[model samples]
Target chain A: MPGETFKEYVDSFSYGSRTDLFFKWLKGAAEADAEDYIQSLLQELGEVSDTGDLSKFFEMTYEAQLAANSPPGEDPRWKYEDAPFTPLSKPLSEMRVGLITSSGHYVEGEPHAPPELSDYTQEEGTKHIGEYGRAKPFLSAVPIDLPQEKLGVHQPGYDIRAAQKDRNTVMPIDRMKEMADQGVIGEFASMAYSFIGLTSQMRLTREDAPQWAERVKDEGWEAAVLVPV
Target chain B: MSVGHISRAFETAGTPTVIIQSNVYRGRVVVMKPARVVYTKHLMGRPMSAPFDTERQTHVLREALKMLETATEPETSVILPDAYRIAPK
Candidate 1:
C-alpha cells in the first residue's frame, strides 16, 4: 500500500483500535526490518479489517507484547493464594492513618534524589524504564508538615508530568489533613512514606516492606492508605 | 504492583493497609492480593485525580479510608465511578 493509503486505512479505525494497531506495528518492527514489517502489518490489517472481527487479533497482539516484555525465567510478579487481613481494632474517628505512595517523591535535599534532579536529561528519562527490575529499592520518609514546594517526583515507570505540576495528584497530604481536621479520621500520621514504584519487586517485598511495616507499627499508625503511580 | 506487595507486607506485620490504585492493573491487583483495594479510573500517575483537583482528590481518599472500617474479609475490592480524563500537558 502507498503511504497515503496506509494512513487513510489507519484513520478509518476507532481510537482504541488505532492504538492497538500501533503497538502491534511497534512490536513487529522491533524484531524485523522496518520496511518489511510495515508491508506485512498492512497486509494483516487489511485482512483483519475485512473480517470485522478484530477481537482475536487484538488479544494475540496483547499476549505477544506481554510475553516479549516479561522478564526471563519464572513469572516475576508475586502471587499469594491467601491475602492477610487485619481489621481495624478502633473506630475510624479514633485511628491514626498514614499515607504511602509509590510516586518516587522526595524532598529536595533528601538522600534518595531521583536522577532527573541531578544529571539525567529529559531523553534519559525515557531510557530509564528499562531499569525497572534492576533499580535499587529505597524509601523516603516525608514529613507531613513539609511544604509542597520542596516535593519532587522521580518515577520513570509512568508519566510524572502530572505529578510535577501538582504533588497532590499522587500524594494527597493536604487532603488527608483536611479529612483529619474534619474528624473523618483521628489524625494523619506525622510522616508519609514514599518510594520509586519501578524498582526491584523482590527487594521491595522481601527487604524494604517488612522494615516499613515495623516503622509504621513503631510510629503507632493504625492504618495506611497506599497510593501507586 | 509494588503497592500491592507493600500492602500485603504491612498487613502481615499487623498494620492494616488499604490500596488506592488505578483500575488499569485490576487483574494484577487481584492476583497479588492486598487485604482491601479501592480502584479509580484515574490515569496511571494521577491516581487521586488530576493535578490540584482537591474536591475529587479528597473524595477518592475518603473512599479508600472508608475501606479500613468497612472491609470485613481479605481481598475485598471496590471500584469507584470516577472516569479517567486526560491530564493537561
Candidate 2:
C-alpha cells in the first residue's frame, strides 16, 4: 500500500465516498480532461471499455454498466430470428417442472466453472463474457441439488447477503420441492441447472441452450422456470 | 438478457418456459419475447423474495408456475403482487 497515489486512495474509498470525492476533484480538475479522466478511472475501477455506454459510463456502478450500453432504445443486445411460440401442453398441477437460473449457484465444495466456459470476473460478468466470446468451448450446465448449507452464490452484482444466508432466495431448491409437495406442480425434476447468467456469449448459448432443452426433456420436465438474478 | 435468450431457446425447442425476473430486464424480455415473464419487484438476486420467507417465496413461485397454464400470448408478463422489502444496510 505504500506510495499509492491520492486517486488510488480515492478508489479505495466506498462508492458514495468516492462519488463525493469525485465531484470535489471534478470541480478542481481541468474540464477539458474530464472525459479522459473518467474513462481512465472507470478502466481502473475494473470496467472493461468494450461494455456499456462510454458517454455516461462514469455514472454507472460496475454492476450496471452492461445494461447501460444496450443499443440506445432497442431491446437487449442480442435478438433471435424466430419469435417465441411454445405453449404449455397441460395444467400446472399436472406438469413436471424444473428450475434454471443465471445466478451462478453451485454446490459449496465443487469446482467453479472454468473461466473459459463461464467467466467469473467478480464484477460485470457479462462484460467479461462479451470480451472473451468463444475464446473457449462453453459448457452449459452446473447441477444444483445440495442442501442449503451446501449451496453458494457465484454471481456478482447486487447484494447476495440474503442469498448467502439462504440459497432459496435465488436457487429455491427447497421451495421447488415444496411446490411439488403441495401440488402446485406435479413433480420437480430430480435435478436443476444453474449457470453464470450474466454472459453475452451468444455463440456459447446458441450451442448449449438446445442441449439444455434436450436434457430437460430427457429428465421428464414438461416445464422449466427460469429465475433471473 | 441471456435469460431471455435461454427462455426463447427452450420454447423454440417445444418445451414451455416461464421467466421469473425483476423489472430490470423488462425491456429486453418484452422485445425478445420469452414464453412467459412473471415480473417481480424483488431485488435482483432475491427473485423469489427474501430468504427463508417461505410463505411469500412459495406464493411467488405458485404465481409464476400458474402462468404456464394461463400465458397464451408470446412475451406474456404477470407481475407479482408483492415486493421484496429492501432491509436497510
Candidate 3:
C-alpha cells in the first residue's frame, strides 16, 4: 500500500509540463511496440501525483535503489571482450564533460532546417539580449560555452572544424583525447554527447537525438553529460 | 545501439547508462542502474532545456547494464520505461 502510494507522487522529468509524454508511452507499454513502449512510459509518469518535486523524486529513486542494492532492470551482457567498460562513477565533480546547443533551426515535426540555415549567432531567433544569457550557461555546447562575457564571440567554430579537408582534422575530438591522455580524467569516457540547439519541433528532436546517442555508443564512453539547451 | 532503435540496442548490448533532463548541479552527475534504456526529453547537438513549448518531445533512452548494485529499485522512477519516435510526415 505504501509502495503504491509513493508511486502516486513520483515525478520523473518535466513534472506536470510534459504529462503527455508519459501518457503517450503508456498507450503501448504492454506491446513494447513503438506504441506499447510509449504507453509504458506514460504509466510511469501518471503515477507522479500531487505530492512532491519530480526532480527530487529522481534523486530519491536513485538513492533508494543504491541503498537497497536494487537493479534498475536493464539487460546485461556476458561477453565483453576488448576492454572492460568502466562505469561513470566519479564524484560528479571531476568529470570530463561536454556541451552543445542551437536556438536556430532544424525543427522536426514541422519542417526541417532550410538548405542554408545559419547558426544561432547569425539567426534572429532571439533579440539583442540573447537567450543564451539566461539559459546559455546551463548548456555545454562548443563555441557558445565561453564565459558570459564572451557572449557574441563565443561561437564554437564547430562547423569549420567539422568541414575541414580531413575527418581527423575537423572538430576537437583530438583535444578531448589529449585531455584524457594527460590524466585529466578519473576515466575519460569514449562517447561525446550533444543536443539540438534551437529547433522547437518534437519531430526534429527525435531525429537528432539518436545520432548523439550513437556517438556515445561508438566512443564506448562510460557516461553522458546531457544538457538539453 | 541502432540509430533509431536506441532502447532495444543498448539494453541488449549490456551497457550501463544514465539519463537526466538538465545537467542539474555542476559536476554532480547522477548515475542510475539496471537500466536497459535511459531516455531523456533532453535534445541533441545541445545539452540543456530548450525554448518554451518545444515539446521536449517526450524523449526516451535505453541502457544495457545495471548500476553495479544489487540494491532494490525505488517505488518512483524518473523515467517511464517506454518512449516513442515521431510519426513520419
DockQ of predictions, in order shown: 0.47, 0.44, 0.08
Q: What is the DockQ of candidate 2?
A: 0.44
Q: Write the per-residue lDDT of candidate 2 for residues A1-229, one digit (tens) a residue.
A: 6886555544443222332321323333333344455666667555544553333332332223224223357744665555676787878889888888777667766644555534453444433444433342222344545666766666543455666787677777888888888888898888887776644456546677777778788889888998877
lDDT of 3 by residue, B56-81 (tens): 22122112112222112321124433
Whole-model alpha-carbon lDDT for candidate 1: 0.73
Steric overlap count per candidate: 0, 0, 68
Chain B TM-score, all predictions listed: 0.91, 0.86, 0.25
lDDT string for model 1 (B4-82, tens) is 8889899998888899887756766777878999888665467788777777888888898888889899989898876
lDDT of 2 at B6: 75
DockQ, structure candidate 3? 0.08
> Over the full model, what C-alpha lDDT does candidate 3 score relative to the true structure?
0.28
Name the candidate, 2 or 3, with the larger TM-score value: 2
- Tens digits of per-residue lDDT, candidate 3, A112-223, equal 2232322333323222223332232111233322222222212221121111221111122333344445554334453332322333223332443444445555655444
lDDT score at residue A95, model 2, on the 0-100 scale: 85
TM of each candidate vs. truth: 0.75, 0.70, 0.28
Residue-wise C-alpha lDDT for candidate 1, range A72-189, written one tens digit per residue = 4433357678889999998988999999999878887765534433354323443544565566675788999998888877765666777778778888889989989999999999
Best model per TM-score: 1
C-alpha lDDT of all candidate models, in order: 0.73, 0.64, 0.28
